[model samples]
Target: MTTSASPSPVLSPEHLARAYSYSAYRQLITTLMAEGKTTGTTQSEALTAYAQLNIQRMERLDKQVQVQPELLAAVQGLQQRYVWLVLTEGWCGDAAQIVPVLEKIAQASQGRITTHYLLRDENLDLMDRYLTNGGRSIPKLIVLRADTLHEVAQWGPRPAAAQELFQAMKAAGATHEEFAEKLHGWYAKDKTHHTQQELLRLINEMS
Candidate 1:
């Protein structure tokens, strides 16, 4: 008989954000990679070995991810302050692709919204709260009213159009490698437009 692990207790958003910010999370990954440490997940060695490469991919995205002028203008008009809290792990491929764009968007908001990151493995309690289809999918974005701590809206791991393509490919029997290659290629061609457009929509609705 196997004993299941207990669930992590939920923690306050402020508490978790204070303990882990986006910059801090990046630093943690950098240090881990420097020391040749494995990824902070319970995944197999093959997946863990890709941590350094994922970090590199994230770095590349940070350098290249751009915010469209229209998206910038829309986010700048946000009259209310919000906190963009993200739950992710460095080893997550989706996160490597998406987090940089989110950071750019938050920065473009020009302090109207601040961004923070919480490691998913370390914050299972919070991750459990925002599960995608009973699974712990990463890059979960939680937008909260800064003053009230009320959740305004949320977005996730990937954009709607991208997710649709992914589901369709999977349904059509695309293997994991093929799916990853195609999805990333799509993102490359997309140049963050889908993510930005969707974010604009979310902002418009929340505002």
Candidate 2:
């Protein structure tokens, strides 16, 4: 089992905008990471802390989001069993930002939340189980139950449409080199947004 450093989750979203936010969130994430690296906090301990923090967030959000149908249903489902697995690189903005929201959701779902932070470079074997356009993308959030893998939910880097640009480069007689350059930049720039969108796809597909 993986261990994370924290009294609660130091969600990935902080990593994305850590340098940008004035909130204490960034410091929390850094501290969590440091603790995990140094103190060897077990997975369950980290997850329990993550759950405790999100429980408060959900308690607050409940007042406002009580009417959301999907949210309510997700909350109900979580009341049963919830396991959250996140695939991310520290450099990913989406993971740093969105994972906190997930923590909150798990809380609302009724105290059933567990978070596993897997560094993408360190976890190729796991990523191979998930495929998109012949590639594996980051921040794939998977929820499971018991020892059985009943995937109620999952998410990943979004598939963006570069078809227009791909075609434009083709028509312009641009080499594959030009196309690759533009495509790479696009993915890098909109990485977070893509993760959110891809997350929707994974959930929909799995559901």
Candidate 3:
């Protein structure tokens, strides 16, 4: 006689919530401000700008964004718990756009997922371990098993389509402001659909 495989166990909300290294969203903003204060000491224009930009991004993300229904549904379907350790800095425009969405995904997953934020500068060793094209990129998401914290899968900086577009624009020598305008517009139009679709694919592959 043929036997059916048993269903996987689902974690309770308490267990699920505990599985992630939770951070208050405001903490990220505070950390960025601190980084700005410290790094601004060097009198670097780029570093100072990064800090200021990230602060602005964090404030907007905290106030305005919402997770779409499809993302919520996708997050809810995960079969196992994961600790999503994200390497990011506040000044990262991509992080500003993406982090809030990630926060939403974790909330939707019940106990199946939790997100922890690590500043890229603060976690250089770990960031080097997951470099994009030999450069340390911010907002890299590393998925780990909740029980062992072993690496499972990793995703980052931006969605595939956006990455492709940005690379093309860079190759064509578009200005940073031009790139930002196009990218933010694309993100607004897409509304995390591409991000959600890509993440769902990754989860399914790892599962």
Task: Give the candidate order by descending TM-score.
Answer: 1, 3, 2
Per-residue alpha-carbon lDDT of model 2 for 30-108, expressed as tens digits?
5554554211223455443543443343334334332234544645554355466666543343344445455545555
Best by TM-score: 1
Better of 2 and 3 by TM-score: 3
The model with the greatest lDDT is 1
Residue 192's lDDT in candidate 2 = 33
* Candidate 1 backbone collisions, by pair: none
Error of 3 at 166 (Å): 1.1
For model 2, what is the C-alpha lDDT against the true structure?
0.47
Instruction: Report the poorest 10 consecutive residues by lDDT, candidate 3.
Output: 1-10
User: By the TM-score metric, which is better: model 1 or model 3?
Assistant: 1
